[model samples]
Target: MDLKGKTIAILATNGFEQSELEVPRDRLKQAGATVHVISPTAGEIKGWDKKDWGRPVTVDKTLDQVSSSDYDALVLPGGQINPDLLRLEPRALSFIKEVFNAKKVVAAVCHAPWLLIETGIAKGRKMTSYKSIKTDVINAGAAWEDSAVVVDQGIITSRNPGDLEAFSAKIIEEVKEGRHVQRNAA
Candidate 1:
């Protein structure tokens, strides 16, 4: 997975799933990609573990400081609060739109598919998410699956933390494939 020139943006906010963000960040970095932790706030963002608050991850850039074109791919980590908060932010939604418009990979896992739905990009896309949100994705026009990971066009999704291994591998594969010209706007 030679991604030497690739840049990935991990978008999150307070309450992001700790493992969902950290695991992929490390894996992508090891695969030779520069991963930026972009958030709605600067300084740092707290993460959510299984039941309580987890460690804080420093913010590399705030939403207002960067554009989607700055990166080769976008990653949205899911935790109940993270996606719920991001779905309401106009800037975050716009950033997501721009990335998809550029035909770059947009990877989400677990509840992160909520962000995809809000961007209106989930329509007709094949994806997998935390089982609790399967209906949500389907209602958004997505074809939901129960698999550990699913990639359609440049959109990649997985079920939950247990699926992170497959999730990370699929992301690396998609990034290596670069743009997907078949991806249509939502």
Candidate 2:
């Protein structure tokens, strides 16, 4: 799908999975979409590598500075701490709700779906996330699956970084299609 003029907001903070954020961000930009990295802070956010923390990514905007009208989609990258922190941030959770309420595309990978659950946006949605979050997803009213990628009602979710390829593709596809309804298709 072509995303020539689309703008995607990526919400993340310290401890986000490095590849989960970077790979999709690069792929989306290559597809002609502008990607903005928004966080709780305005400077930079650190990343979590395989066994240790990694470099920080420059932040484009703070959570307080973001608005659903400023972007076409929202992306939440997961790591142990990333989504955990986001789920507790009122502003961050509210931003996610705004995206869902606006019917805009929202894509999340791995533990990132935790934020979706916290935002109360996972109800009746089918999704996939890190194996450890199976119960969490189910408890949040979403059908949990073990797929590489799942797209339901404009919400895109993946199991982990390993599914980044499929995850990224589905996000672009949904954004281009502009229409999605919850289904167990994936």
- Candidate 2 lDDT by residue in tens digits, 48-78: 9979999899999998887889989999999
Would you give me the overall lDDT of model 1? 0.94
Q: Model-by-model lDDT, in order?
A: 0.94, 0.89
Clashing pairs in 1: 124-141
Model 2 worst lDDT run, 10 consecutive residues? 177-186
- Backbone clashes counted, model 1: 1
Per-model root-mean-square deviation over C-alphas? 0.8, 2.8
Candidate 2: residue pairs that collide: none
